[model samples]
Target: MIIMKAKIILILGIILSTALSSCVSIMTRTETDVHTISERDTIFSYEQKNAPGNQDMGIVYPSSRTFKSERRLYQRDSIVERKYPDFIRLGVFESVGLIGTVSGESSYGTGMFGIFPDFINLKSDYSGDSGKLFSGGIYRIGVGEWRLRWFRDAANWTIGTSMIEFLIPSAKKQNTLSSIFPLYIRKRYYLREEIPYIALVPSLGIGWYPSQYVNLSGSIDIGSLGGLNLRAYAGFAAGLNSQEAYQVRMSNESDKSHTSVFPYFGLGISFLDFVNIVPETYKEWKDHEHSSWNIGLIQASLIAAGADSSAVAQNSETKLFTGFIFKIANASVALPILNNQLYLGTSLANFVVLGFGEWGIGILPFRVGYWQTIIADELSTEPFIEYNYYPSNFLHIGNRVNLRISDFLNLGLVMGFASGETSMGIGSDITSQYGAPISFSRAYFGISVGVSDRIFFPDELRYNR
Candidate 1:
């Protein structure tokens, strides 16, 4: 046992040392074109003309040592508006929120449902004691209305078509594809200027075909307008003649066409700025320095935790997990002490242990954290259904030291701490009267890669010019 413990300590020390020592330099060398101008080409110059009487009056001048000759270059600032291709207008949105089956058939499974997206499971078993309230997350892809140019200067209304909408619900055994090819209209009220930092948006969607549904919601968006932003919303959704509703009706042998009404409230991220329709006059000088709104769009990590020698010897093994952090929006903050910024987003993680795997979503407070050039720290709270155990809430605290490879990519070393509950028995058997439970605290270490904005380096504002 002593030798085994020593090995574990040594291994951990080596991992930490390697991670800390792998920092990458953020400096880049660039070539500049030098222009030579002759004295005759000088745009403007002046020479002192000694006045006839003053020249003989013994007027004195400063020593020649104080005078210096220098070459100067001046570049005029120009405003440029980015134009998008007519056919390439696209948008991606993701949201997480609480859903309640307000008015639906109690005997029928009224949870969220979807189609397409192979990862979604169709059949659902709602027999468990789960209540009417559950959590859900959605992913949407939309096209059209690029920047609402048709609205002219108003540009406050957007009419688009969603190509796909996928829904994942908690308390349900399977995932579902909600709709495809739905017409949506959104109206926004700006609280400030053209690039307003805050706006109220109300939207409606109507779906037809495979499943019929109506979604109505109102949301408040914060952060950079038209680009990456954070969204909070409350709305009502109803499925009439949806496939899942029909299944519930058929299973119950009832003539009534089942319908489900879900009232939900949640937060999400919107990446509508990808269409880049903001006018040049509304853009700030720094806006021209970056082509994208976020530092990173997507991040993935491979992690391992809970390495107990006794557990490994017993064949339980250490837990291996894969995590993904999706960027919703980010903004630079003005602070006195440190280089700081706020990140608003969500994360999804899959944990595998002893051949069993489970998925967890971190929504709500989303991901709120600070990131400097090379280091980042974040906190998240999520509900996880662990392998061989019931659903439990877990708190995660994580840190990362990033090594930037380029303006578009970064690799990082990650260390995290998780606090939750672990079952002492096998499977759901831990819930039995004879089962035992214990507190769970594990340290996870791994590596992550991000498709992000320029990180781990000084801003390359000169390159943009």
Candidate 2:
């Protein structure tokens, strides 16, 4: 629920920024080229400029009779009078470009924190295992303000940090023995990863300015994530001097990149200037930087020759495999392939959610063929896999749906039976499939809180939203 709130906030910020940017771009565009008036002499009204100043300006004016243009007049009787614009025009996106933006933030005080009790099931039988998800650890807090940046352009950077502490719901710790010595420890999942930590993020990116405040920013950020990233931090200020303009700032920094392609939405400031740096002026109103959210899905999957979640006994006689559930949270990475049609992604699924809490997250890095439409229609097959984390082996089959909503938001609902299995020697301390034997997994569901689509414009076609 907390993560969902943060997503809502960031999405809103992106929306606000896009809207404001579009307004500024249109408001600032030089609607009519000063063919008749030079910038140097533009100080006075075009009709009022004296001949000497116009002559000194050395700018040439097009002959009104020679230039071709649509007469703005609503054709009435023979005579014509141009119609005045009802309102300014705002730019819209055509194809897709990138934008980059940066921000600085600071919280007022210690910040907002809260807690709630919940239920957790670690065993296959949900009834017997359902326990206090947080017998005592139920605690959450919104840390200090964090600085953020949106990388859309070629040269964009962002840096932000927030101090946060997580009281991971405490559950009954498994005990060794009472006869030998009273000993109990927290579950490996909640213990190893839970701690009072600080979120750190810094990134660099560059994108094309499709419009003032509308940048299709493509950024690569490396940062820490903690306590549902506080929704957002925003500011509004006004400036009229040459150095400033009335501006509003919005920013975002998600360490987890939803799609390897376009995954970040940063800021939107309105009522300012417009320029493309390159093709500085296309001299076309059609070159609009679409400032809208795309709610779409990423239909893709992965096949890996890797160690499964199940471990193999090096002795051959018996495998004293470590009993830990592979985390499926951060095992997949969004690969925005060509036409934004293909995505190269990997997500780990566990048949059983054990003490270690079925650890996993999406991962990137795939062959170009995996991303390209090498396979037609995506086959519409149910793709699935089972990992033996111990020996580092996997038996994968079928096809899976990459149901993504926002550009980075995805919900992986996998339902299928595995048809094959392969094994590999485990390299100690692997991020996945470390020391467990492969478990045959049936239909499984992985819930994700980050972006997941190659194209960020799904909302245009899919959502009632």
Candidate 3:
């Protein structure tokens, strides 16, 4: 009853959240392009006089726009109309991003810690033995997780740690143990207008829980198959315990011990940047270098040209972005070849590219495909197809019914197939993680959050003329 009630509550919460999401708009206002203006002399003169020099501070400009233009290279203080739409949107993601940063950095140092004794007991129902045996040992498995992520520009660097315990059942007794991961690091780079991003992780460290041992591990996350994150970690460990605590000696059996090569897997919100992490130093510098006069120049020029500043701000153009999506996801992988055992996985989709015409490749190192909207209106249907290869090889094809919950979020149901096998999942393919094909599984349900000025413009903003 409790579980059912909890599930009901969860469903209700999702409904409420989705309803609220529909009301939230991803407001966007384009930066005024002087090139669009018939008169360029005013802008040129302002640039000439206010350009920064080695000795002259001149007039200041918003540093946020420093990298806003590719053509304005080498011009850090380029002044243009402050894009009002960009800042008009409520700082929704900024707050969430800050929360992630804080939780990630402090989890390792302030989380739970303890030491306990472990016991192994044999079951009495064994057919091979009528007697029960028991053994005891001391062990420590730090149960906690921490991830510190840096999301700036189009790059992300995430460092994290997780402690997981494993249980081994033998003929005589059952033993419990856990692995201590001191460090895990990943670097992600985004490709504009593409869906496949790139990610790399390197590992180096030593662990001393079970015994004095050196550890080395690494893996790449492939993020194309949908709203799941997947990764593999393998390394060699010296002085590790043998798989079998006791083995009977046979005529052909040798007493030699083999080095341990361990493979670890993880699934969950792998690696993503819900919001950009603005550095304090950069923020301070930008704040100190503010130039109110440039803003005045822009407003005066517009007014002189018979334009209203408020109108210019409100009439800003909309920007369409086509770029590679970088994402982190919650996911899992089944190691069928190993032991048919399921392992949790953390993944980074480094190169999920979304280009013009809504084309891209993603779901990681295993899949490549295309997505298209069949119908777009008050309601929309998008169908996507991709080829997947990994634990299983197959083709995935599916579609989604998307209803605007708000400008920044979507609620939908997505279902599809792989070759003859079937797989289903729900999510919008906007962020690098959620808006891809669901691979390796058969079914899923999801929600997607993103940025948009509004889902449906107010009647005043829509002009039939």
Cα lDDT listed for each candidate:
0.43, 0.23, 0.28
Per-residue lDDT of candidate 2, residues 1-465 (tens digit): 434654795586456445543443323334442223222212222233334433433677653333233333232233332222121111111011111111112101111111111112322122212221112221111111211223343221212111111111112111000011111111001111211112222322121111111112121211111101111111111111111111111112222211111122222111111112112133233332322121112232222212223232223433233122222222222223333333333322232221121222111111111222222322122233433332222333333444444334444433333322224322223323333323333333332222323222322211212
Best by TM-score: 1
Instruction: Give TM-scores for every candidate, taking all chains together and pairing residue i with residue i.
Output: 0.50, 0.24, 0.28
TM-score for candidate 3: 0.28
Residue 52 lDDT (model 2): 42
lDDT of 1 by residue, 155-179 (tens): 6666667666644343332223266
The deviation in Å at residue 326 for candidate 3 is 24
RMSD of each: 14.6, 23.7, 24.4
Ranking by lDDT: 1, 3, 2
Clash tally for model 1? 8
Which tens-of-lDDT digit does each residue in 1-465 have in candidate 3? Answer: 434654795575455345434532232233444432232222222123334656434877444222222222232343465322221001110000001111111111100011010111111222121221211111112211122344543334544333422211122121222245544343433232122223444554454344234444454533322223233333333334434422212112224432333332222223221212223112321132210000000000011111111211333443222222222222222222322222222222212222222222223323222222233423444454545332223554544455555434444554443232213222232223323333223222223332221222112111210
